[model samples]
Target: MKTSMAKQKKSKSLLRREWVKSMVQNRYLYLLMLPAIIYLVMISYRAMYGILLAFKDYNPKLGIMGSEWIGLKHFKNMFTDPYFRHVLLNTILISFGRIIFTFPFAIIIAIAFNELKQRHLKKTLQTIYTFPHFLSWVIVSGVIFNFLDYTGPVNSMVAAFGGERKVFLGDKKLITPILYITDIWKESGWKSIIYLAAITGINSELYEAAELDGAGRWGKIWHVTLPCIRGTILVMLTMRVGQVLNAGFDQIFNMSNTVVQSTIDILDTYVYRITFQQTPDFSYSTAVGLFKSVIGFTMVILVNKLSKKMEGTGILD
Candidate 1:
């Protein structure tokens, strides 16, 4: 027993000495990594110090540290506010609408792109599709205004056909579908890149065997292609679930009008309104932001667990 104990201690000490020697030898490499570590500390953790404002009755005169703590006050107000249900409903509807409507479109488009035999045509199509994603929401909004406004080309076409000019952006009934379709237009192509990459990673031999076994194009897509890319789908869905509350702030802010506010206003816009439209109550805004973050974190955890249960794997894995 005494001899065994001595050997264990000697082995641990040797390992520790080796680790120390390796680190010292690579000290310059460690030094090279310091800037990124410092940037992360500055950008990610430095702002965490301000999170204390969430629990405080912050006053500009008193400062964040000087303010009185008021636990759950903002949270309670947030949940119980009159517009809470509306904003929550819109946020949820818009998020799930994208999942149901836009997500499948991206998948289909990816599969369609993967089927293209002509490389030049495929590359051109991909470039055309992805170009829209590079455009800023501000610029896209301007283009949308140009295309959909009362005097725009769409309404002109309607007028030519002797049909009534439609309100595309502001009508409550039209907003949900408009939001989803526009999202599909702007992001579906770009989002398909992940699926395309996943498709590429799939073994070509699987497809060759399927072809020999009398599987048709559609059959192969349904049976082989989809199953292979299903993990990527699950991971993307998990991420989308995590972002359920993050309704596109820039798009909503730019495209929403007074008439459509009740239809499209979301949690992010609510935070902005509180901060800028109302009194600049730092505590209140921070509380709202913190609440959003907590919900998103909880959602990611829950969905990741659910994915593990159903698929025997998870986004984290």
Candidate 2:
């Protein structure tokens, strides 16, 4: 036991020495990382202390640390709330809807861009497709309202064609589809940039070898392009899974109205409403936020495990 203890201490000392040596050798690289490390420490890690509010009866007179402990009272109330259940279901539905409909468009667009032979046309199309991503949700919501309003050009065209004009935004059945469509339009092209980059990094020799084997464009893409970028796709998918509960707060908040409130009320908006629109309940809101974070984290872990099982690689790995 004495000899083992001495060896362990020696190993630790050696490790410390090696770490100091490496840090000194990479001083410039560490300097470049200092700002990011500081930001994470200050903005991200420091803010984690507020998570305690979920377990406290937060009072204005007493700050977070001084708040009275209420140990799971808010969590119990949250679990029992019928409205919360509805909101959670809505959040899950919307999140999965995006995964099903919006996720693949980026990959498809990236592949399509890769297949394009005309450089000028590709650049122009890419610019047009990606331009929407820069626009704030407020602007996009306003444009959507203008286009879909009863007296707008879309309705006029419907009237011209002898079809009855409809309230697209206010209709519950239409609202979710509209959200999916608009989300795809606004974000897919920008998301495609990462996939395009992955495609660009694929070895050229693999394609040449594929062609030598008499493989066509579609064949090369199937066997070479996709397989080469599978790891990147899995990594992005794992990250997206981590945000499964988000459900696009900015877009929904901007586009939502009283008529469509029940259909589109998600967790973030519910927290906002309870905290700001209604009587302030900081502890309850914090509990809801904590719940969301837990679920998102769980989803990320599950997806990462599945990714590793299927692809022999994972985001965590």
Candidate 3:
């Protein structure tokens, strides 16, 4: 009994010491972080109460809290609605396609840029490549429209070859592909920055050692360079999974017309159309939005957990 008491006393003392140390080291940092913590709690976490509207027959005068609750009504409507099903499928397909295609291209750009021996040319190329990313999708849509118009440069080229000018924007078969390719082109170069930073952080000594072992360019890339940056790639993939539902809202909103709306309508645009145009069912739109957010949150958690289980590190850490 005496020995047990002594062990308990020792544990209490260790806890006290740790508490004191934590107080000294982290007290100021905690104070500094307080404002941001509170701001997030207020703006992000607090706004979650509006989710209650998802269950309500919300009215502007009644407000969210005063609204009449009808649980699962909106959710049932969503599943049964054929248009919602199509948009949901399109959203998932487009988002996943972008994640798979864009990540590899970013890594390839980083690796290729890393090997450039000429400083001026490399910098120039980097600047040029990144330029398109800053252009708004509205601008991009205008550019595409001009190029694909009947009398535009692309159509003119086709005409010179004795081929007919095609209306690309109105073509349902080509709309989704056009969106994906344009997104890749506009964003891939800018996205390479993170991967390039990871590549540059790799130890130069490893490259030297590989060269001494007669490892050629491809050998160094496959064995040394890629392995060093695998952690960054995994983290990127995890973050991308979290953004799987948020596939380029501005791009789709600006580019979509009545002609191809059915093919490219994502969850976000669908919500917008339902709330503002077709029917002013704010509660129903909120319910659909809430569903998308829940799915995205689940995807992030699952992906992060699987990543940790496989490699022992995740994006959160």
Tens-digit lDDT track of model 3 for 1-317: 99999999999999999999998999999999999999999998889989999999999999999999999999999999998999999898989888876668889999999988999999999998899899998898898889888899988999999998888878899887888788878888999999999999999999999999999999999999999999888888878878889977899999889999888899999989988999699899999999999998998888889789867987667
Question: Which scores better on lDDT, 1 or 2?
Answer: 2
Candidate 1 structure lDDT = 0.89
What is the TM-score ranking, best to worst? 1, 2, 3
lDDT of each: 0.89, 0.94, 0.90
lDDT of predicted model 2? 0.94
Give the per-residue lDDT digits (tens) of candidate 2, residues 1-317: 99999999999999999999999999999999999999999999888879999999999899999999999999899889999999999999999999999999999999999999999999999999999999999999999999999999999999999999999999999999999999999999999999999999998999999999999989999999999988888888878877899999999999999999889999999999899998999989999999999998898889888888877877787
Report the C-alpha lDDT of model 1 over 76-188, residue by residue, as the tens digit.
98788878768888888887887888889889999999999999999999998999999988998888889999989999999999999988897899987887888888889
RMSD of each: 3.1, 3.2, 3.9
TM per candidate comes to 0.88, 0.85, 0.85
Candidate 2: the clashing residue pairs are: none
Q: lDDT at 67 for candidate 2?
A: 98
Tell me the spans in candidate 1 whose CA falls farther than 4 Å from its real position: 1-26, 308-314
C-alpha lDDT (0 to 100) for residue 139 of candidate 1? 92
